[model samples]
Target: MGGRFGSPLFGASIKGFLNDRSALEGITSFGSFGIGITGLYEYHLYLPGVPGLRPFLGGGAHVATGRASAYNPYADSQFSDIYAGLDGVTGVEYVFEDIPLALSIDVLPVLNFPGRIGLWWNAGVSVRYVFK
Candidate 1:
């Protein structure tokens, strides 16, 4: 009865910081900011006989939004717009037996219209709790 569990789990995280498209495009004339949230289902992918460490993978969709602004001295005004998009994520995680914690890194590639396709990555420490 210890192979893989069939249930749903919930978790949350805060990102340290993010790199904006303006920097990637080499456009210093504009300023931008971005943040994201995600929900996913976990599926075990390791051998059941293993005891110390376990590895798993997850897939989900996330919605992110950002704002960009550009200044124009000739027009005597600043141009700004807010944009949002949805992205897909897939990554692996590792859980240690000695502690009730897990660590993972995921690559989230998004398709944004009126903009360019870019990849956003997130890596952080996480804690896992079992509920029955």
Candidate 2:
């Protein structure tokens, strides 16, 4: 679910997470999973032409689906009914001068829409090889 798109300015990825109900809750017996995709643009930040730490800003979209059931004092359920959201990201990347390999870390703020309005932050790290 991760790979570079042959360009330093642009990259794409898809990711997912899973959790078991026993781990999530002490009573319920259901599992859940979520998936999302993102595209990023890395701006060539200024540092006297240094290619070590290039900071960038970009945005993309995401879609996630999952549900968890609760059964302790009463029966209840929660779902990521939002389904989709817009993502804003800011990050810094470093490319090895002798090779086409790059590594980066980013923080993303998400805005979910429609009936399930919510905001959250996501942070990640990525490594890529430019095929230029």
Candidate 3:
């Protein structure tokens, strides 16, 4: 019951983001690279006898930052914008003891200041390392 079920977790990941609005007009695209780091606490909730899958929930904070540059032909100006946001995440994960790794994907909509609603999507993989 305590093999891969009892431990504190930590990980880092790189993601691509599609900002709804940017400095340019008629052009909204996903990021080339948006990197982030995370720290999390996970707890197992399923019974020991369950052979199917183990479910767990985690909560954590993530930081993402990126820069965008675009050329506006009409305005004849090059605009560069830097974007950064902090997000709070809560999601479920599935652990399969048959394999040595656990895979998880979570929707971490963020609250970014200086923007409307500031809801951004963040989803990625988390490699788990269990400790006794």
Candidate 4:
């Protein structure tokens, strides 16, 4: 589990490797206003000299439902909103040797529409416990 806080978002995520260089992630996030779910496919590049360090780029989509506190000008706080968006992520992850832990720093840019077109970006740091 990790905190991907663009706007104080707390969520849990599961990551699985598809091959040596590709991975997938499912993320569920919640805030005071609502909840969001996202899926991403990433391609990782390992550095030649840096062990356990990889940088990745990915894109996916998200579906969210909730009320807007102030983030969306179109949605009122009293009502709930259901929207979908496209997401792009780029980050670096480091896995510790002899420890089942990974640390990541990433940025996500999202575009949401149907209600309105909203484009924004967020950066966050996360610590993940890896289960083997």
Candidate 5:
């Protein structure tokens, strides 16, 4: 569940992720999927010197249910981990003047706590339609 709000230069996201559990853990043996929700606030700095290009920065929170590997001196096991943490985002976007679409590429780095205490990166491209 994800949607974009606001104008092309600035926006917010209400989104969720359904990810491959193994991919999330950076392993191949893990089988399952993970579900999570995220909220982000973004601000874009448009360069007047260069039209149609904007660089952005954002911060947000994510909460999810997934499997993460827990390590011990004696044994390591996969366990249910809660992903409740903060994420920082940075990206660049280009607005198409002929069309109502804005294309962006962003990288999100997360720090989890109370469950999986680690850092992970979620990097992807997104397309948004402008209402105005």
Candidate 6:
């Protein structure tokens, strides 16, 4: 699991590759604000001679049912309502050759529908244990 930049949310993400260039990720997060789940689709771009390094781009959606303290001004600290949003991800990752591990750093910008329409920055770093 990894923590977010602007908030105290900690999330667990699992990614599965569909092909050499594409993958999908499912994420679950929890914090003082509440708990949330996100899903994303990613496309990997290879760098020549860099066997395990790649840059990726993707988009996804999230559904959350709890209080959140983003740009919501309805409540003093948070909004007690169900939230749905669109999210985008861009990142670079490297998989270790000798070890079953991967490391990535990414920026996830989210737009809360029916709420915050403007994108908010959400940067994070994550490590994954690859199962062969």
Q: Report the number of the highest-TM-score candidate.
A: 4
Worst 10 residues of 2 by lDDT: 20-29
* Per-model CA lDDT versus the true structure: 0.35, 0.48, 0.37, 0.80, 0.53, 0.76
lDDT of 1 at 20: 17
Q: For residue 48, give model 6's deviation from the true position in Å.
A: 0.6
Residue 98 of model 2 has an lDDT of 85
* Model 1: lDDT of residue 73: 15
TM-score of 2: 0.61
Give one digit per residue, the lDDT tens place, for model 3 in 63-129. Answer: 4333332211111123333334445554445556666444555545454443323555555445453
Clashing residue pairs found in predicted model 5: none
Residue 64 error, candidate 6, Å: 1.2
Off by over 4 Å in 1: 1-32, 69-86, 113-132
lDDT of 3 at 73: 15
Off by over 4 Å in 2: 1-32, 68-82
Error of 5 at 51 (Å): 2.3
Per-residue accuracy of model 5 over 1-132 as CA lDDT, tens digit each: 123322111223422213311101111111243445666666667687787787877787867655543221111126555547787888887777788777777777778766437776666566666544
Q: Give the per-residue lDDT digits (tens) of candidate 2, residues 73-104.
A: 11123644325667787777676888877776
Which candidate ranks first by lDDT, i.e. highest? 4
Which 10-residue window of candidate 4 scores lowest in summed lDDT? Answer: 69-78
Q: List the residue pairs that clash in candidate 2.
A: none
Clashes of 1: 0
Error of 2 at 30 (Å): 18
Which is superior by lDDT, 3 or 4?
A: 4
lDDT of 3 at 2: 19
Over 4 Å off in model 6, which ranges? 1-8, 68-79
- How many pairs of residues in model 3 come into backbone collision? 0
> How large is the C-alpha RMSD of every model relative to the true structure?
13.6, 13.0, 13.4, 1.8, 11.0, 2.8
Residue 12, candidate 5: alpha-carbon lDDT: 38
